[model samples]
Target: MENNMFCFQCEQTLGGKGCTRHGICGKSPEVAGLQDLLIHMLRGVGFYGQKALEKGRKIDQDTNKFVIDAIFSTLTNVNFDPERFVQYIEKAAEIKAYMKELAGEIDGVIPAAAEYTPPMTREEMLKEAKKFGVMADTSLNEDIRSLRELLTYGMKGMGAYGHHAHILGRMDDTVSHFFYKGLAATIDNSLSVDDLVKLNMEFGQVNFKCMELLDRANTETYGHPVPTEVLITKKKGPFIVVSGHDLKDLKQLLEQTEGKGINIYTHGEMLPTHAYPELKKYPHLVGNFGGAWQDQQKEFDGLPGAILMTTNCLQKPRDSYKDRIFTSSIVGFPDTAHIKEIDGIKDFSPIIEKALELGGWQEDEEDQKILVGFGHNTVLGVADKVIDAVKSGAIRHFFLIGGCDGAKPGRNYYTEFAEKAPEDTIILTLACGKFRFNKKEFGTIGELPRLLDMGQCNDAYSAIKVAVALSEAFECSVNELPLSLILSWYEQKAVCILLTLLSLGIKNIHLGPSLPAFVSPNVLQVLVDNFNITPISNVEADMSAILEAAATA
Candidate 1:
């Protein structure tokens, strides 16, 4: 049978392979096709945008922001509305036309992506979209397609980080320019495997810079995150549960709902907001609501409060709570209320009103608190103590085990891995994947907690910073510092973070629940040979291997 759509960008793609008919994340084939067309349109914009940059002509920040947002919208579980993608396609065409005019004369052969025009109607758009899907080019080499998709997915993750920084009034020219360069490279047939590999590495470096820029934007704007304990139990009253990774949206919602009798509870990545001094000051900002994004349908069923999804990690809403869910920023779902910014400010009044009408829970749940807010600033602040513990053999090893979580089986490996880790080891975790064992009791080593909760996935910046600091203090390279990265990947953000680690020459990283389907055997071999990246094994064997390796080292 012929396939209707093709997507394998996320870790949970159907059968450890491509999702041909529909997405495992609940996106319909029509939405998948539209997302493909949207990506295709962005590449067209990138062609002209790259040419404009070569001619020393400036691409406006508006165009840069649009490209970043459009790319971000294509990441797993971000936007699922076909109509919204149609609008983005239209806008991308306009941006491409403007860029073409600005780029002036072309010096060499033009790629087909640069010359293609989007169709007019939704029906025509869907038909045209099918031809531009990932499987569109049958003649392209499989390895080349693998590398191209790898680079593109990395850029998609970089775009998510860039968008977060952009929202906070931060911009980096190097990061912005690479988006155009990398996007155009995907279509440049003259580039060989080695050339694409080099580009992928180059993207890695740029993505590190992007992640760093976002780190600064978050820390500088909100004041560096400090250690704070957050309440996980819900309270009685009108409340709104904010999900995703947008701190600015959370800050705005906190401000708008102040003293309005509506409490705000964070869900998913937003759980770290409690550590930011500026955001946590609001009395109405209460506690965290649910676990990871994968459990939303079960956790949110018949929820009393409203839900505001600021960015990605949005599953299709269940009928139980669909009416009360609100989407902001680039997140969109059909038949949901959307909050748009006016004058660079989001009005969450719709969500606020929805919560007021729902009236929240009747009685407060029993209080349960968990530790968070151990960002780079907090961890590095006590660097001397950590170093001292390592020297004293109180902390024998460090395990960095975290990434995107999913509903797939074998994820219990992380829980058991962390559980079986020796008492002398420290587990540094971040991202939604930590939800698996964040609530577990891992006893402290001296004054330090055995498990540290870093910030959101973008806060991989924090983990990297802490590692570099440790390496410097111990007088060893990061890879030789008795640390191991066992990551659980789900989407494009994880792809870029993994690239950033590989670009830094870090080795012996373990990845699962399953390897990305888009990574061909040759590309996978390149990673294994160059970086020693390995697929995760069973918890007992992997743990014993890591411990033995550390003991010998």
Candidate 2:
């Protein structure tokens, strides 16, 4: 079998056309098709599953887990293993069959698509897609249809995050139901672009709830995040750098390495773990090791520590460190060591042992601390002071310059936008994309730091909390405040966050690095007409636009 595969679900694909032979991320055609089938089936399951639940039907955890995991499995650079995806396909079929059994007359299953096989014909694949809720067939308007598709993609992203949270015993019924609702809505022909726009906001509303639930699960289990500095340089010896968003995996790693003398460091989204009281309590938890997800090939190569990926935002691994990488839960890389579930808890002793055998830096190296731990609690803790700063006119503007980063060079717009921000502004950042500006010292305004790090992508919840708090303090809506959201997106997680923002009725958001490949023209118009969603211009132009709008208003 050839080692390469093809996929085009992400914004950057071969030729802006469908990937035919091998995906940029190294996925083969088999894996790509399987991932599509998995997503198509998820839509079907979500359609029937939501209806079943509404009728007071109770769905089992396995069925729920399957739906969640299946979506997460399709994210960029997340799943590269064909065997694992094949299993997911089987699992999806199982769930669909189970739901059909329960419902007696399932509406979303397309018979021709249900029995399709791999190395499948394009015709067969297209027929199978018909079963996936039909992409808002009732909406004749292109804009409405496009927006519906965009919203659907966003829900898929949110569902993926929600699923990760669910695996750790954190389940939100509202979030789960929305997945069903959104799918069912796709099948509803009466939905207008206006209706879809409203649903778009609901996507955000549900995502907000989902984020809160995950936040509660994380803080409750790990304790609230606290401010702490992380080290950037790698120390020689045996160590493992854990990245992405799964604290459960981090906790397990910590427990396994308690007395083993292997050092642990958080990378990317995991950087904020330093703020959590419980996870931070570990002495061996050393510091942060790398930058954003896109920089992983350079960061992880020739490193002394093993790399553990817990969730999405995973990049293609470089050959240098490929053998040393491990993935757990829904993440899968071809041929890498996958941490399998054992007795409901994954034992990461292999990663730990590898770290010990590698023998990290022998001599104590110069340690540096990078500040993190500013999740919602950390921000809320200082909300009163933040409110004061804004009231006193000390913090002139609040710029939320965070979202997914892509390979596009134009994405440097985020860095420039932040760089060109007014002196009195404060920057709130989250997700992997923040790496572009995170290392830059923007100094401070008044007593507050100009750049405030808000943990991982899910920590967008923190930004909302702060925004709502500001709104309450000022006796105005969130839109009334002197805040602007300049987002850079490349994946589905960003989709859900945008939906959550819309749900809050927050408008005039500037999104860039191009919109989703899936959104049709009609949908783009709806987003622009209703939400004031605009593409990112040059940094200077965007900054001026943001500031000019504030000044004029």
Predicted structure with the largest TM-score when compared to the true one: 1
User: Candidate 2, residues 154-190: lDDT per residue as tens digits?
Assistant: 7778866787678669886777777767866665667
What is the alpha-carbon lDDT for the whole of candidate 1? 0.92
Error of 2 at 525 (Å): 1.1
Q: How well does candidate 1 score on lDDT at residue 19?
A: 92
lDDT of 2: 0.76
What lDDT tens digits, residue by residue, belong to model 1 across residues 1-553? 1347899999889999889887889989888988989899888888889999999999889999999999999999999888999999999999999999999999999999999999999889988887888889999999999999999999999999999999999999999999999999999999999999888888988999999999999988998888888999978899999999999999988989988999899999998889999898887888898899999999999999999999999999999999999999999999988999989998887888899999999988899999999999999999999999989889999999999999999999999999999998999999999999999999899989999999899999899999999999989999889899999999999999998998888999999989999999999999999999989999989888988998998
Runs with alpha carbons beyond 4 Å of true place in candidate 1: 1-3
Worst 10 residues of 2 by lDDT: 127-136
* Residue 348's lDDT in candidate 2: 84
Off by over 4 Å in 2: 1-8, 15-21, 105-148, 187-195, 362-365
TM-scores for all candidates: the values are 0.99, 0.90
Q: Compute the lDDT of residue 390 as modeled in candidate 2.
A: 77
